[model samples]
Target: MMNSLDISEECNNAFDKILKTRRSIRFFRDEIPPKELIEDIINAGLFAPYAGLAVENKEYFRKFIVIPRNTRAMEKIVEITKNIMKVKSEAFKSEMDKNPYLKKKGAAFSKRLELFADKGVLGIGTAPYYIVIAEKRGFPPVQQQSLAHCLENMWLKATSLNLGFHLVSATAQMAEDEDFSRILGIKSGEYEINGCAIGYPKENPSESSRPETKEVINWIK
Candidate 1:
């Protein structure tokens, strides 16, 4: 019979496999994942790290908005995201002009910003579902950190289920947009938001490379 040590080793190995297999999947099949499966992933997100004492509302602190592909809602969000990226791109350009070294070193990033400002991300509508996860702003203002934890949990859950996942990071900057804020039924700046796309992949991409554990880990005595 397997002992407790054997069970612990098995669990650790399973989790390691899940972590190593996670990838940022951009292209996806058109088929929509079952509603229950999506809920399971979102449910995983709720269990992530949160500042329980920071917010008074225990019942409705975090929110998730799920939109299907090719819908009017998706259209509005895509347009809003593009506009926000445009503002971000312009701000970066202004900074680049002010600093000669910044302009030189930021050339590649500027190109990426231009792409976002112009066309937005194709994965927004390519995936069967676009999910916006919003965290309620609190006194300490650690909402973004909480949202990051929430997303990582959801991403890992999706990976374990063989679903594709992509981060729509521009959604974080749209909190102050009047039109986008209205869609969430919250006042501007009331929430810190992040978004992601999830669905089955069209083709499996290889896992991303990572530095050796010894290369990055630091120990303090």
Candidate 2:
């Protein structure tokens, strides 16, 4: 017979285990997450509290285009993403050349693009599901902030569900570009500010590194 203290200790241990096992999980097993489970994660994000005001507004007026697991669709997305990264790198280099002050930052940005290029679009060739979270209206003050907050909530929910989420800022840039924008049906001009790749963890390769602590957090008594 287990007492209340023993049960509580067991629960705490289980929770710690979950946290320890949780990593970026670049690779994943080949299995599609259930539709209901995905919906549940989104719903959790939708219910997140607003910044301050009680404005009841939907994040996305249009439907989220869930790209199928087809090779053609995946290849198209990868190609688009690659081109977007190239364009951004070129633009950044051009800007740096004109402004000497921005040279250091430009070099760093170019390096990131090169590293991401090494991995390509599907993120280590493991992510099977690509969720393009797009919002309709890209204006105003409150609405924009609200939408960003919604995205943050969604990312947290994804982590809690043991799913891998990699934000391809370059993909969002592609969403805004002239040619690719048409594919997303974004009013022929609107832009997607963010994009995330979600899927189960794979096993081909494992483990990714994160930066150690910076001098950001300091507790006061």
Candidate 3:
């Protein structure tokens, strides 16, 4: 029979596995996650800890916009993203001309952009669902930290649900474009923090490299 300590250790191990196994999947199968699952994931964000005693009154601080598969909106997003990539590629090349150190990196980046434009190789593929996480404009640093906490919770929830999750930062550039924001129905004075794509994975992604804990952490005491 297992003791309470053993049960506690088991729980810790399980949580560790979840953290280790969560990968940012770029490709996904064309299946839409169920409505209930999406709700559960959003609820996980809702329950995340926020700053200030007025937490109950701060619902407006965070918002989630969901885009389902193959809709006109999704197509618009994909097109806009492609245009943004093109602009980024040009900017990368211009910077490479001024900085020799960036030449190698810029070449690789431009190659990827070519694949994305010509071969349809997306950094974040056409996942069945996309959730745009937005925050009210002019939030202070603490509240912004709270927004990040909310996203981390949603990511963990997606991992626990056996779904592929990819955070799409490229969309933030699109959010800045006034026309694009209008298409997405984001009014003025709101900032798009980032986006998350969710779907069944096309393949299991390999583990990414990470720096050793000792390299990144220090103990003063």
Candidate 4:
């Protein structure tokens, strides 16, 4: 039998593998994740630490809106995202025209815009489930930080369950549009901070580049 230290090291290795394998999935199969699995992921989010002690406060409320395979709702979201992409592309093109440096560096941005147009949505994938992370407007930065932790917990949980997960930050703008906000069930004073797409991945994506620990960290004596 393995020693306790060996067991601990094995568990650590498994966690590292999960962390490394958790890529931002851009394509997913046309299938919905099990409701129980989604509930477990949400439970992970709920278990994340918060900033304040007041459980009743709006700031402490962890709000998540799940849209599971709703064709009409997805259609509306896609339409709004397409409109936003159009406006952004036009704005970027205008800026690029004035600045030669911007014109050179913005090739990748232009390509991404084209891809969004082709996909008919801002998200990286056509996931069967879309979750909107919303919070009360004008909340403190600490509250936002707490929500971020909650999201990370959910991401890890999804990865452990062999589910695809991708953060869709671009769709946050949808919360500003009255009709889109209404469709998403966002209250008048609430703001959509982030969004995520979840489903079973069609393909396993390669790992993305990252900076070395030495470059990103500082050692203090």
Candidate 5:
């Protein structure tokens, strides 16, 4: 049995470990973590604070689930996603060229945006597992930002396990593509807002950059 003190100590240790090694791993080993472990991580996300948990009488709340695909299969799916993005990039470039306002953003910005629309998505390359979290908005927008918090927990948890993880919100591009949706069993109008790529880190990684917490925190009494 875990006493209060023991639990607190464990929590602190987990947090320290997480902060130390939670790098956004872009390169992944070929080995995949066990499917059950992946499911366990998603379960951790389900416990995250959301509107559903905030109110006992709320009429609606969102349900979440994760899908675990092997590295090879995920690679194939990513290829399809890349093809769709190429078409989207061409369209975006054409639109930006037509609008003088967009042109003012600078060629580098537009080019990077096009590249993001092209290859910034690392869903399959980084992690052998893909965890997609979605919700039903009842056809109208509702405050669902809480889902992000839930995902953050999963990302951090993966880090604690010495597994690398990063959220790939750019999966939204694939969400809009019909072919991609069909492959993932996603329906229209449903928000597949985010996905996380998770796997073991490579043998040697570049030094990580650590940001000062003060930049993100503002104290108000």
Candidate 6:
């Protein structure tokens, strides 16, 4: 049997590998990951930090609604999301046009918006599963932050599972859409929503770079 120090070193090495290897993958194969593995990924998110005090209801504070590809619900959410993005993209363009700084800084973003507005988010249909996460709204409406934490957990879990994951960020703006909210069995604006697409990657992911830990850390007095 391994000693305690050896066990600790082994865990540290495994963690470092996963943290360094995690990268956002866009292109995915049509093949689906096992349902059991997907459930494990969702479970990873469910245990993520939540606003215990800020939650209006403790019981239904968080929900994971998984929609499989090529289904009517998937079709409906994609349509609803596209409609939402189309409106947001137009407004974003108008804002960018009027602001010189914004126009310059958001050029790449504007291109992405154009594609999303026209065809919907890329990974939604390409991946076999579109997972929607909903966090109930509360006093300060800090649900979005909690939703973000949940997604990050799911993202890391997916990376560890050798699954490609894409953030469907546009779904964050779908809160006020009554049609979209109804599909999730929640009233409009009652909950903050976010989504992600997950599947097997078509190709191996390239290495992702980041600043050295020492460079980012602030050893303040």
Best by lDDT: 1
Tens digits of lDDT, candidate 1, 99-120: 9998889988888888988998
Candidate 4 lDDT tens digits, 103-217:
9999898777766655666342378788877755553455456667778888888999999888876665455677667876776446635778888999988755688879998
Better of 5 and 6 by TM-score: 6
Pick by TM-score: 4 or 6, better one: 6
Encode model 6's per-residue lDDT on 63-165: one tens digit a residue: 8888888988888877887888888889989999899998989988888888887898876666898888998888787888998899988988888899988
lDDT tens digits, residue span 63-160, model 3: 78888867887777677667767877777778889998898666877777666555443434478888877766553445456667777888888888
- Model 5's TM-score against the true structure: 0.74
CA RMSD (A), model 4: 4.8
**Once model 2 is optimally superposed onto the true structure by TM-score, how far is the C-alpha of residue 172 displaced, in angstroms?**
2.6
lDDT of 3 at 11: 80
Q: Clashing pairs in model 5?
A: none
Q: Against the hidden reference, what TM-scores do the models get?
A: 0.88, 0.68, 0.75, 0.75, 0.74, 0.88
Evaluate all candidate structures by whole-model CA lDDT and list the values in order: 0.87, 0.59, 0.73, 0.74, 0.65, 0.85
Model 2, 16-51: lDDT tens per residue? 554454454455567877777677666755665543
Model with the higher TM-score, candidate 3 or 6: 6
| Model 3 residue 189 distance off true place after TM-score fit, in angstroms | 5.7
How many residue pairs in model 3 have overlapping backbones?
0
Q: Would you list the clashing residue pairs of candidate 4?
A: none
